[model samples]
Target chain A: MKRLSILMLLTLFIMVGAVGAQDAVTVTWWMEPSGSDDHVQELIIDVFNASHDNIQIDYQPQESINDQLRPALQAGVGPDIVWLAGNAAASQYVAGGFLLPLTGYADAYGWADKLLPWAYGAGIVAGELYSIPVTYESMVLFYNKTVFEENGWEVPRTADELWSLAQQTADMGLVPFPYGNATWQPSNEHLMGIYLNNYAGPDNVYAALIGEKAWTDSEFAEATDLLREHIADLGWFGGSLEDYYSLGGNDPTAMFASGEGTMMMSGTWMFRGLGPAFEETGMEWDWAPLPPFSEDADMQVGPYSYDLALGGNLGVNAATEHPEEVGIVLDFLLSDKARILELASTTGFGEWVIPLRYEIDDFPPGTDERVLRFHSDFAETTGAGRYGYTAWTFWPARANQQLWEAIELVWAGEMSVEEYLENHAAEWAQDAADGLVLSILPRE
Target chain B: MAFKIDSRVGVTSAYRWRQILSNYIFLAPVVALNLIVIVIPSLTSVYISMTKWSGLNQPEFVGLANFERLINDPIYWKSLSHNVIWTIFFLTIPVAMGLTGAFLLSGIKRFQMVYRVAFFIPYVIASVVNTELWRTLLHPRHGIGAWLAKQGIEGFDIRVFGSKHTALYGVAFVDSWHFWGFLVIVYLAAMYQVQPDLYEVAILEGASRFQRFRHVTVPGIRPTLVFTLLMIMIWSVPAFDYIYLLTDGGPAHASEVLGTYLYNMSFFRFEVGYAAAIGVTMALITAFIVAIFVILRRRGWEI
Candidate 1:
């Protein structure tokens, strides 16, 4: 009887609190901006505020979102929504229980069905929805059509042909790839995926990550040898391993933009930035898979390694006083297709102008035809893998550190691929001993 | 006689008490500020040093683990060596250039203020912006250094920064440009204060300018030179922003000073405890260098 009275009084208090609160509640949001194009977020916020009667949105642009949000989230005063890169770091948020579980909300609003299956699936961590997909990007090899045609070279379709071209180009005293395999991921990701897809194929690549085989597998050994030999012989990259940091993906894109180089391995997103340059140079540039292996074996450019399911998402603070109102805001902002398309079209106020989803017609004023056709072929062929696919994400931080350090040795010429792989395996096992997850894939 | 002695003792005791009271009164604000600002934060950091916290909520205690990792970590050692080299290198070039410029300018009677202003201008500029200016000047493509190569100068495309052989030195060169100015101004002031009599006596003896500089000017400014050297040694260990902005401790951690390394350990990898160990190591290094300077001073180095 006493409990029932307390429950009734509690319900009454909530009712009073909700009814008494008439002032417009302000919701703070944190996002990263790229000065000009990133301004689209401000417009979206303005539109949302103008249409809403009960809530106001305040946006904060940060230079380093991880550094800022990591502290804020832990302090329990984080923004209602945050923008984060799609990677293992994003998984850390979900794993730490800092993010609100949006599954219930998604189910209630039918968001799961509305979003692309792959896109919606990307943000799910431990079977819980933590973020919604915002943008998608894929890494592909871009080749200079004009340079190749001038050289009378057929576009390379396999690793051997690619190497042959690199050698031929080196003979003529020009940089072939101009890539240093020395930087951290996405660089490592792009390089390793290209090698693995050609050598072990996608099946083995996934298998290796999940412990179906060893990093010292013969195919892996051969691939590493092949890559190292090419590096030693042709010497494509002009800068040393350390110079890798100075060379942005865009640096090569800039090179491709000018008619200086024949090929660069980069993402389709960079195309938007480089399209004008390509047009000015009158060079037809297009994408291609890392050439498949010559061995008539089971492999193609292993499915695209990282596809964006979600760049970041908005989540309400679980401890906030206005959960219902926050929910209404989220529903309006994310669930409405028209709002999403507008947000997409404007490129989220310049955060990403290339919408995650776009039809060919939606290309910006000077989009390249060859570039689109190559991406279409590549996308259709490659399977999109999860982002944040670093060794440290699954294991203890030490294991990841050890792996990165070991790879540096390879570039330094102190260790071979076999030795490096063996060391990484040993380190991973050690991390397992120290209590860290080593596998996230399904068991056979 | 006894009364006189008693009165003297009483007066001394009273004087001591008054001195103590004034000292306390003078120190009260500083004590309060230290407790409120420095001491409390330092204690908090020490406590955080034992945890697995990434500057985030409820840090988990992992005592001695971070230290153990630092002891074994190769990059940690590599960074330490870089810091030591940086500290040693930072001291030499800046102090040498400063001493040389100070000596040359002190002899000039006219336009002393103009030369002083020109030398000190670089010191007043922000380090990041200054380092960036140097970056453009050193850029491999269109940099002034590269443009000189177009004149058929061999080794002109020197790409000094991104090279493993030259990256740290490149950063050091940039930092020296910022640091040497202060040393120059300090030395110049010390030189200006020297009595004209010393130079006059040397001149009367028919000593040349070089001899006068060595005999009179060097001895007169000995204390200033020692102080500037000690100051440079102290600043070199913790001075990270220049190296960070210029090279980002990269080109394979070639320019990894203690400050930038500790920052990367904490911010990049979220290894707070390990970063603390790095911080402690830095403090210990600074303390050790300061002690050496103190010993040198006691040995008649005269700073």
Candidate 2:
């Protein structure tokens, strides 16, 4: 009689435990594959699952997140949380009522205090936070240290110095800035944004973006002319325009690593690929702030860097059944700075957007010193009010498209600078009138 | 007796009606699939073309405004002209190459199968792989152009896909290189079906090789030739992968075709309404070509 009672009680306990396990909330997360960072994301997901018993996450890595998310959201079926490319994409989803406004959760979680002010401001649409920034990026001048040393050239800090160095580099048979836009024409925006912010000054470009000034303003025209001269007449890229077009995105970095090119202008995100390319050649490379494009001290933003909102912006699907659980997952992902830094240190996944509370010296062991210094320098420069803007993160869709297309025509000499500026200005003005322009955070 | 005969006829007529209804039931799945995938999307596309939509917000009824904009858009006209040029090039070059290849292969016997497989291999390869292969081969630094320059050949280092003047032709050449082989296999099958007596008669009449090809082989393969031409005209309307992968209609809109333009407008610019109008225009062009072919057939032309 005692044995029968014990066996019955044990079976009942086993059944109750199984029922409890089945009741755990399942949250689906859609992430845009970031090459090597995908494994880091998977690791984070596993850690989260192991730490929490009430919630389970199913991670789905998508090749083209926006392309897939748009249709699925329209059909009223999508993952609980999605990774958007930037604030521009988040605004589109917010307008469509596909994203859940996270104002209350953000306040409860103290996200505003934890996140950088500019990053927090970027997620607001019509006075409500609809997304959480997961990554940050900026453009800088990348140069081959070996080549610069061999040629006895100092990194230029002013517009005049830059032009002089470019001339000397050309005389030495090395490309001053190796650029390519044939396969990926939109990459032209990287160089254009840098020049626009540096030459025209961030204030004027900001005004133009927000419709307070015209693109035909003299500052913009000056920038356009400078680009044309470099591309067409000067040929600072070491070849004809045709040769520039023939080169692919990776070709410039490869050339620079091989000591065939002196300098390259690209985003910090390129460090992932450059790290490996430089490793192969045992070549030393470093970055410098962009040279000022204006001689007037007042016009320059003190080596303004064209900072664009990049990386994944996590948002909750409005139709998700588990909103609370999804919010919890987002908080776990963004709030854990230690784990993020540790991952960044160990795996070179340094693109996380959260402002670190810990000291730079506390970075985990095995972190690449070069990568750490790069991020530290980027944080310092952007913190000093030298950050500018990028079109992909700010401009309306149509205006942004026209910006690159018009510039290509200008580069090909098919359209004059005046015509290009006027055309873009008209399109931008109309988009502004339609309330299609995204909110631009004021310069700090 | 007359009433019995009437009853039997009524029972047979009722059985025939049941058979017809069962046949329709068997075809319902295919008809439903066609309606869902083809008929519905086409009709929806036509409706979407008349509205201003960004694929995110509610589509505003703009009624023909998109078409009006397209009429004034220079890029649209440029893309359309490129497509026309593309059609003409494929009609001449690839078709001629396929015919010549088929004629030679049809003459050989020992290595016939091997040659056929070798020629068709490119057609079987994926577009991305094929494009990447050509991109490397035509690269200005390390490709054939660079090698020729290394050998002291002047003017050989020209950037083919990079130059606006040559980008369209370069993409067309790559696309043709992959496509001509399929046409060869098709033409060879049709050539084999031709009766041997006709060739014998031409040979007995003291006809030269060219004369025999013109008199016997040409007429014998007329049906396949006409069919291939029609297919080429239709396929050229949506020629996207090569040009898109190669130049993306770029280096200053030099190789802009309607297909790539439509894709850019829809996905990149979010001008779905304008893209739909372009799509509708493409459909009309295809329909017009089919109508012309039908008319020719109705007028007693063999094609």
Candidate 3:
């Protein structure tokens, strides 16, 4: 009995040893969901592992991805690849010297011509490709079809028609427009996109941001004037400013879906969050270009591009033992552009046309139809001439926060538009005083 | 007798050595923990405050520049003022309310358990959940306060946190809800131990309830009140989670306290050095207030 017991113990130890000796390559990726779906990471990992022989992709979802990434990169323990929401922070990360320059690699892979020019240029900083643009985002008008159809009103093709329709909708006792001023992106960008394109004209707005003209100029004042009119004409947002954070992108879309408002201005990424409910509403809704301010003006719509840059990239730590392997894996991941788009669609991320190898004509199952419409719109618009480039996108992350906070202050009536402009100049002067300067020329 | 004395001395010396060794063994874990968690990080923060660290890369030493910037930063000054006001407001008002609540609860004989639980519920709830609940309740349009406004209650229709003038107060009122219960519990526990004989003796001498409270109950719980007040003063200075979850120090930094301002500096702006300076200043201010309370307590004053 003792000999048999010893034999059993020896066999168990050997089995454990054999299991521990299994060889696998572990690659860590940092990702924050740019859309509503939680299954994006899981689905991608499952498929990638199934297709590969000896590789495993580990995903980490972070709340403040930037904040955590900065510290981790500083500690020389950052991930192998990072999926980012192409935004202003991506450039800042590249400037911080934490991202691997990918210009040569992107060219070698023939990815330069695959992505849109705007999307590709958005990720470049100081003549280096720090990141690959994964997705494109834009703010657009979402209106209640049932309400408009019931009123026998055509979808407004001009700014005047929109306001006139709003008045008519208000007379019918429905909230004409619903948006919040709490968040800079949802509140300011949403309003600015429409106001800048339709009222002030996108060219003048872009020039002002790049310092070709001062923000206090007459054209800028006209923009603010237009904003003020929206406030005066439109009813109060359903919730208080304190609840604005929660009401930001998703809740407001939900409000529009539930018939709380006739129209809302929100980002395209919201399609996934509102998709299921929209399917239930059985309400026929269609996308339209933002109407022109005058009859002669072109239909203006602002493109919301998530500029994936090195500022948001995951850099393999130089300190890691398997640097070559990590690079190889990252290269493989970026090589498969079709898979990236598929992963994005599954993740409920906004439509992005990756300019890399393998283009799938047919979208995978679970891809929302609204997303397809946006993708086509992106192809038509190319986001040039109509939309003002994101000022936050080209600047450092710190500067962006300051700008947003200043915008919030102005919106809260703490400062006048004039004071806001003055503060903007002072803030820039302070940045100069602190030895930070504009690093890139503004897009023409 | 001399041999016996020698043997006793030998035994006592051996015992003394063992006792010292055992005491060190018991204290080793705690001392190591303090060194690893608190002392090392605090020292690092102080060191980092003297540098130009942006939560990334090597921190370059730029002595006193961060501190100078903090001194000139208007937002920092405003946040400091808010912190000070919050401390003073909590120390004076919440303590009194707590005392009043405790005194009232002491009179109830039946349903006392239910009352205690009711009063303690807010204290036990997570601060974030409580802040969210109060934010909803205090919302202008679709909240309880607004519902009251629809029923003809004046001043309740307006958003409690909408204006700069009332934003901080709205946050303060929400915070007061969670804090008052803790104060009540502490005051009650202290009041329960007050001598029954003193109250009876005061009553027999024809003292009214108010007089009895002023002389007996107040004197008996004075020490507990002072301790709680000092602790509350320290806590109010760094009170962050409630404000962060609710206001985000918005409407033009009207509701900003030092903690939120510091957080924005570091996490939002990536200005770690400036944030650390703010943190050090907060620590100093907390220490100074605590020292003042200690000094006043030593003077046996009832403030």
Model 2 misplacement above 4 A: A1-17, A303-306, A346-350, A353-359, A365-370, B1-16
lDDT of model 3, residue A440: 43
Model 1 RMSD, rounded to 1 decimal: 7.4
**lDDT tens per residue, model 3, A67-178:** 6777787777887676543444554455466666767666765556665565566666667666665445666666788767876778776677778877776676666666
Considering just the first chain, candidate 2 attains a TM-score of 0.92
Docking level for model 1: acceptable
Indicate the DockQ of the complex predicted as candidate 2: 0.70
TM-score of 1: 0.84
TM-score of chain B of each: 0.90, 0.96, 0.92
In candidate 2, the residue pairs with backbone N, CA or C atoms under 3 Å apart (3 or more residues apart, or in different chains) clash, namely: none
Return the lDDT, model 2, position A277.
83
Compared with the true structure, all predictions reach lDDT values of 0.64, 0.83, 0.65
* lDDT (Cα, 0-100) at B139 in candidate 2: 92
All candidates: interface RMSD: 4.1, 1.5, 3.9
Clashes of 3: 10
Query: Which tens-of-lDDT digit does each residue in A1-444 have in candidate 1?
Result: 999999999999998767655567877767766453344455567777777767877777878776787778877888877765453445556556677777888888777666555556555666777666555555556778888888898878766687788778767766676554222332544454455545666556556666677878888777666655554434565333433544443455556666556687655555555566677777777666555554645543343333222234455554456656666666666545544545443432222432333445544444345545643553444334323232322333444554544454575576678887787677656545433333354422
- Higher-lDDT candidate among 1 and 2? 2
List candidate 1 stretches off by more than 4 Å: A1-22, A36-38, A94-97, A179-189, A216-218, A221-226, A230-233, A238-250, A279-282, A293-296, A299-333, A336-406, A426-444, B1-26, B295-301
DockQ for the candidates, in order: 0.26, 0.70, 0.35
